[model samples]
Target: MRRRRLPATALAVLALVTAGGCASSPPPPPPQTRAGHPERGAQLIAQYGCGSCHTIPGIDRADGLVGPPLTRFGARSYIAGKLPNSDDNLRRWISDPQAVVPGNAMPNLGIDQIDAQDIAAYLYTLD
Candidate 1:
């Protein structure tokens, strides 16, 4: 018996139809948090010099003994040993540590709301 093969163009069309007719990239990851960008948060962390007092896993020069290590900040359940480890509290701590916990070593970095949100988003990614 003799066999016949489909033409290249026909095979290409078949491939497309079999593969859902068109190619598309995957859906983007859901927003990490409301109005928060983890990538930007990382940069902001570095820019604000948070690494100078804490040991962050992904940022360079983030090793410091003054503050507790943040390698697993996402797993933590409290900020400054007082506030709940919720996103809001994290943002509050980042924006005004002194306000959250008076006489604490963590100083107020004057981080804006949006920046604080982004930083919180990044911190949550540690897990």
Candidate 2:
């Protein structure tokens, strides 16, 4: 018996139609909170020089390798691989990393509660 194969272009078209454009979709907006401001948080992240360590998305010149890349921070399950990624926990971790895990790479930036909230807000928008 003889066999025949479909052309590559035809296969590509079939795949695209069957998979619904490969499931590509714009992610939903990050949940909002009254106390935090994402815009302000972006400024704070730059002012605090967080980009020197972590490669944060959206922020300019946020290319760093010391800390983890914050490309999809909103989808993260845990902060510092320890505490839950809730707003409160994230705020605490941002404010004082040493206090959270005792000797973690993220340093104690002396960020106040409000600033931490804002930073968390900005991070959550990355997703």
Per-residue alpha-carbon lDDT of candidate 1 for residues 73-102, written as tens digits (9 for 90 to 100): 887666776766777788888898888778
Off by over 4 Å in 1: 1-35
Q: What's the C-alpha lDDT at position 12 in model 2?
A: 94
lDDT of 2 by residue, 2-99 (tens): 98999999999998887764225533333465359999999999999999999998899999899999999988767787766788888988988998
Instruction: Please state the error at residue 35 of candidate 1 in Å.
Output: 4.9
Candidate 1 TM-score, C-alpha based? 0.71
Question: Top lDDT: which candidate number?
Answer: 2
Compare the candidates by TM-score and give the number of the best one. Answer: 2
RMSD of each: 14.1, 7.1
TM-score of 2: 0.73
